[model samples]
Target chain A: MTSANSARRRKPFPVHILVFLAPAFIIYTLFMIYPLLDSLRLSLYAPDVNRQEVFVGLDNYERLMTNDLWQPRIEGAIKNNLVFFAIHMLVQNPIGLMLAALLSSQFIRGRAIYRTLIFTPTVLSVVLVGFIWRMILSPLWGISTDFLDLFGLAAYDKPWLGLEETALPTLSLISVWQWVGIPMMLFLAALISIPDELIEAARVDGATAWGVFWRIRFRLIMPTVGIVGVLTFVGNFNAFDLIYTTQKATAGPNYSTDILGTFFYRTFFGVQLQPGNPTMGATVAGVMFLIILAGVLLYMFGWQRRMLQVEF
Target chain B: MKKLLALAVILTLVVALVPATTQAQDKVTLTIESWRNDDIAFWNDVLIPAFNAHYPDIEVIFAPAAPTEYNAALNAKLEGGTAGDLITCRPFDLSLEHFNNGYLVSLNDLPGMEHFGPVARSAWITDDGSDVFCVPMASVIHGFIYNQSIFEELGLEEPATEPEFLELLDAIKADGTYAPLSMGTVDLWEAATMGYQNIGPNYWKGEEGRLGLIDGTIGYDENGFVEAFEALARWTPYLPDGYQAISYPDSQNLFTLGMAAIFPAGSWEIGVFRGQDPDFEMGAFKPPVPEGADTCYISDHVDIAMGVNAASQHQEEAMLFMEWMTTQEFAELYSNALPGFFTLSDHAITLEDPLAQEFLSWRDECESTIRSSYQILSRGEPNNETQLWEVSAQVLNGELTPQEAADIVQSGLEAWYEPQQQ
Candidate 1:
């Protein structure tokens, strides 16, 4: 009887744990891992003269890196993706952090209302956001121009989405506007989670309001910042819908706004007059996967190791 | 055991009668997938009724997708082995790719294929000329659709020569009353339609220029293509400010609303143009050629072609529908539905719309050779049409010279061809 009791106490290989996990595990494997592995496998082959898929083994990757037709587009897309991430980090995160700090203060009234209003845009569809912005900024409609005119800056109004020099930056800023709410909410949660005693102590020690944030609250929320940064990085690299909806698959006005996501889309699905090659498309996806994986690894090992957790 | 055996016999009898009952009904549904969502009314009001009247046993279902999304969706469906019985085939590389993949059923043995002219048939004929894959539906003539009132008000006649066209653009620019061209480069394909299709054939004429491209003997940087880009560049100044930001529909609005003088578009847009402005008087003209060119070439090609899916279970019914599409009744219905689209029927159909009549007049004149757009002639690797469109945009934006634009296209072509040669 003691042996049987001990055996029960030992967990009996935890078969029920697997039973609980089986559904989610099967779903994740079937939808996520299977498609990813299949795409990776597809990257090794290429279409021949007869349009038959023939195994070329790393040839698609080699061509993507070295071939004149694809290399420029791939490199340009990667460069744009980096810029996209950087803009979100520099402009979006800082602004979001500032907003969160302001909203999280004890003195601030109607904090819930402010939070709801700010977070509303994040819930709105990207397509709706893109269309609204496109119309607002349209040179033909004069909505943006009229708004600028109110501030005596009508001369500055140009086709911001059309010009090659301004297109990518304009698109980035638009994206930042829509998504800034996400980081704001995250930072707000992190700020609220911080023990109020630490901040009170900092204030009692003759620290300024700014000093409290800089010395206490900011440091405690570094983990959230790291999480937000990694999330932004992954999200920016995977972005396609906004640019596609607004600028199209060409990422046009001479592909000035072309990024990795749009590039991957074009390479995989193709657009007007261009035929899609699944192998090449898969190769682009694999490359993007590696790039995202590198960014994640860098965060996990490099940044995460250096980050010291603060205990209250 | 006796009861179980009796039940099994009854079940077998019921199962066996089901097929016979279905056969007695003799109902076969045929699905046709096409990009002509705008023609849904015609399909419902005309084609379906006519088809049902002739053969009530076969029911036709028209599955329409938007032009932009059709190819990719159809490709996915075909690859997954779940495509429609009758599939719409795009001209050029897409159709060729489908044929090469053995996804298309040959229409060579189908009756009424002879109604299609050699040019129409050529669009769907296999690379090896072994079989024709699709039935040609309609031929679209591409050129400039100009505001008749705007032209009259400005005293601008139809420019018959390249120099005259440039002169007319200058006059319109100087007048400053309206944009000389309603160009929507935001779509990108518009630039190709204007730069390559409307102009390239004027430079690259005859079998030598056409076949030379496939053989790589005639490069895009040659004088012919250079002149084409140069011509497109010359019109840049006359385009609306921020034309690159304009979408296709908005540009058409510009033309129809008299904000712009001209819209470079296909003949198929006539219906939409008329629908937009009932009283608007629009005139069609073939884009003029350079001074020394022997004959002007108009960009004309088969618009929508129908092909049977190789994996279709009901191909005979699908083929019957396709055969009926070639009949005079169907042709009249199509022409009546879409007024401006030219059909491939030996039986003459009268064009009622004045603008369509004007376009047909050009066809009857025979002074111009009808050529497929450069987009259709070129294969879809290194994406020549897209490359040309990009370069043209750059040229218009003053970032690249016309020569540089031509060179960029040539380089792209070389990149595509050199690898294939290896």
Candidate 2:
């Protein structure tokens, strides 16, 4: 009798709890969880004779890391991915930080207009963005040269998108243009959240405005900075859409811009020149997953501690 | 306990009801997955209306995905076992594997294959001749489309031989009014298609030569293909400035707007040129072969085709749609929309564009032998297009010597075929 009574009296979940959780749970599970789990399951098997997928243990990963045709692609992709991520960290984040600092200044007028204008690009679809930039940079149209010539920078311009040496970096800058707004908004939010009294206290101690910002505001926003850094790392590692849109899966100019995303796509779907190999694709995706996981772990364990502040 | 009971009931009911709801009966929908290139506007404005008028029972939906997206989405659907009932199969589509996977129906068994031309049937039929995977939708011919008005103004007669062609181009270039020829290399295949299609089979083995290529008797660097590339590379001096950076539409625009004298393209561009400049005096001609070459006709290959999904519930309706699509009555309807698209159905219809009509007449009058595009060759074997793509780009960029490119293609073929010899 006591057991039955205890079971019946167990903590009640209100009707609203079910109502609130049901929709989200169904969406997340159906869209995200199922596909993820299915992909993971598919990674375990390799296709064999009779075109049937048979269990192959870790052979797919082994072949991908050690095979002649595939090994170079994997190493090249990793090196290219690191280079891409580094460029974004050095160029994109700094530009975004500078823009945020400038926009958040107290004397800046029409801040809302500037913010909206800057954010508008990030809202555009990557395909539309790619086409727009392609047209602007086209030598056929000469719009980019004409526009640059008005500012007397015509000498600085070339067919930047077509050259092998400049293609990846040019694409990176284009990406930076589109995505800078996101980090800028993050920095802006963080900047606004810093207590003004801390800066005032620093100023009262004979600190200059720049010193006050550095000593107080910057320290307080270290957690936000760390978060932005981690976000950038994850985002760059998973980057596929922009490169796919601009360069196709091959990431052209003789594949000089072939990063991990393009490599994964080409392996997964196969192109005109190759047959689609699912095992190879899964291996590439698995490597990408490990890379992202590692970056996230570093942020969570190592950087998280450094960003922590204790109040006296 | 009550809350848990409610949660369990809700979950059970949802899972149970999902299957309980059968596909709504008496509903028939046919989706054609096509690209957003030349066919998009025509399908929307003309094809859909004509189709709907003929068969009110079935709704035709033009669900366009761009080329890359279309391929990926189609592959996923095929892999997921939910591909469209009618899908566009490009020249390089991996549909052979899709057919093997039981994704496509045997289109040969469909009701009306007798009406199609031999080339059309051959393009889509299985190698064993037991089944047809698709019905050729229309033919795409690759050749030089010239501005007739510009030629007339320059007093340049169409060249009848290789030397005559070179002399004409050199004269045009020397006059300084326009470049002799222009092509966009951004697509990577435009140059090769121009070179290979017209001359490949001639140098190859006539019809037997092509068969040899297929059966591995002839090698990839078969002297014929190399000869074609070498002849094509000589024209680089006459092409437009920054030719490598040019894209497809930009080249079309250049030809249409009189920025250039000639544009190399498939016959599909006739409608675009007509739309862009109705008064433009444009006509298509077969590119001249090198001196003493056996082939003279422009290569016209079967283009996009229709096929029924094997797994479709409405197989009968889908088959009916495909048969109806290829008839003379339907051909007339399509011709009314997209002029310059050729048909073997012998449709007696008035064309919208006179220039297109002239080109069609010329095609009919000239008994010149034609060949298939390189796409057809590469489609049968893996990495055919890849090797071709790289070599074409290298030839254009002058990065690879002609002999080197030939050796590369030969090695590529050996990698795929040599193992079979053992």
Candidate 3:
């Protein structure tokens, strides 16, 4: 009787646990896990000249890395994708942090209104944002020129969205404008969660506002920073909409704005008269997965492992 | 009282359903799946009524998806056996893919197939030319569309030669009353579709060059292609200020708003132009031939067509409608209703839109060719169509010399194209 009781106690299995997990597990498996595994499997094979799916393990990767036709495009897309991520990290995160810092301050006026106004673009459809921005920046009919003229900067105005050098960076800024609210809200939540005693103790030590932010608040929110960084990395690497909307699938002006997502799309669905190659597309997707996986793993193992989460 | 009311309700229900059940049997309904959603009103109000005039029993429904989503959506519907009987065919490999996959049936034995010549049917034919899958509906001609008032204001005449064309643009730019060219590279296709393909045929010698490319006798780096790029390069100076940032719609607005003079355009823009500004006087001129060239070339590319879905239950009714499409009445109706979309039928229907008529008149005055890249060359990596857009844009942007642009396309083609390998 004791053994039976102990066995039951040790098991600690509640049948309700599975009952609770069943719906989510089944849905995630069907939608996410299955497609991901299948796509990974597809990367290992390609259609032969006779259109038969034949095992050609690592050949697609080899070609993607080395073939004259594909290598440059892959390299270009990766390079552009890195630039895209860098822009987010360098510009978006810092601005978001600043906004959160400002909004959290006791001196700021109408903080709620400012927060709502800043966050308004985040809820707008990406397509609508792209369309509206395209019109606003249009050289022929755009009001951007007039806006610049008001600042005595009319001569500096160029088709920032149209040029090869400017297209990606300009798009990055536009994306930043649309998505800044996410990181801002995240940082705000993190700031609010910080225990008041720690901050009050720092204030008692006569720490300046800047010193408090850098030494106390920023250090305590390191975990959130890591999360936001990983999220931005994953999001920016997979981004397609704004670029696809603005530059098209070609990633035009000599493919200055081509990212892995657009590249994968063009490969999978083809563009113009070029027929889609599913196997090759899967290979591109496989590379993208590797890129995002590496970033995530680095965050989890490298960054998060070292981040000291402050206890209340 | 309850029994009497129940009985009365049953009788009325039977009466209502009686006609519906009978009508469902003898009346065959045909749906045409098309990307031309803009023409739904025309199809319903004008073309369908005309089609109904001959076969009153056959009911036609004009079902369409957004142009960009049509291909994927149609394929999905086809896979599920729920597609329309008649499918609007995108030209070249896209339709050819359908036939190969058995989504579209061979229309080789259709009686009306005789009405189309090989050129009109080329877009839908099999690789070995054994089967024609779609009936060609229309082809859009590429040319220069200009504001008639702007031309008059500048005292400019339609140029017949490349030198004269440049001179006219120079005159307009000098006057500074309007932007000389209202085109942009932001939408890369405009550079290729309206610019390179529009004028490339002149330098490449039309069908001779196109057939040569198909036959593996021509190289993109050759004089013809390079010269076309050179001509495209010269167009940069006259383009609208800050042209690089301009998009297709922006360029259209510029032209329509009378801030720009000339728009390199496909004939399909006629309806759009008219729709936007009913009183806007527009004139189209054929792509000017280079100096000392006796034969002028124009791109009269097949744009759209209709095919029978192999899985559709009502193939007979669909074929009947397709047959009627080849008739003179349908041709006249289609051409008049959709002014810019000229019918592929042999019937020489008069166009009411002067700009559209002007575009059609080029067929008589010049040699006609499809976009050189569309048929087969675009099937592989470094797609000719896409490459043309990028290279043409780069060349116009002065980022690449014409020679470099030509070389890029040639080498890119050589990478995969078996013929270009040599």
RMSD of each: 6.3, 7.1, 6.5
For model 3, residues B131-207, the per-residue Cα lDDT tens digits are 99998899998999999998887788999999999999999989988989999988888999999999999999988
Q: Rank the candidates by lDDT, best first.
A: 3, 1, 2
Point out where model 3 deviates above 4 Å. Answer: A1-12, A309-312, B1-31, B56-61, B76-85, B101-115, B309-320
> Whose TM-score is higher: candidate 1's or candidate 3's?
3
Can you write out model 2's per-residue Cα lDDT over A61-150, one digit (the tens) per residue?
887789655787788888878888888899888888788888878999999999999988999999998888878877677587889999
lDDT of 1 by residue, A1-312 (tens): 999999888875878899999999999998799889989999999888776889999999999999877889899999988998899999999999999999998899999998898888889999999999888877776498889999999888888888888888989999999999999999999999998888888888899988999988899899889999999999999999999999989998888889988998898877766756789999999999999999999999977777865544
On a 0 to 100 scale, what is the lDDT of residue A167 in model 1? 86
The worst-scoring run of ten residues by lDDT in candidate 2 chain B lies at B366-375
For each candidate in turn, the TM-score is 0.88, 0.78, 0.92
Worst 10 residues of 1 chain A by lDDT: A303-312
Residue-level lDDT tens digits of model 1 in B207-291: 3465566666777778677777888888788878777687777787778888998888778789888898788888978878799
Residue B365 in model 2: lDDT: 38
Candidate 2 chain A minimal-lDDT segment of 10 residues: A303-312
Give the clashing residue pairs of candidate 1, or none.
Answer: none
Q: Which 10 consecutive residues of model 3 chain A have the lowest summed lDDT?
A: A303-312
Please list the residue runs of candidate 1 whose C-alpha ends up more than 4 Å from where it truly belongs after superposition.
Answer: A1-11, A48-55, B1-37, B48-87, B97-115, B206-208, B292-294, B307-329, B345-347, B366-380, B418-422
Over B1-422, each residue of candidate 2 has an lDDT whose tens digit, in order, gives: 23336545544543564343335456577767666565777787787777777787787767677665556566665665455678676543365556766888877666667777555565666666577687666665566678887899899887756678789889889888886787755556665665555545445534555556656676656576677677667777887766656666777777777878877666677877778887877766666655776544445566667677776767887888888876776777666566667654544555666655655554453322234323235542336666676677667666667778777776656555543232
C-alpha lDDT of all candidate models, in order = 0.80, 0.70, 0.89
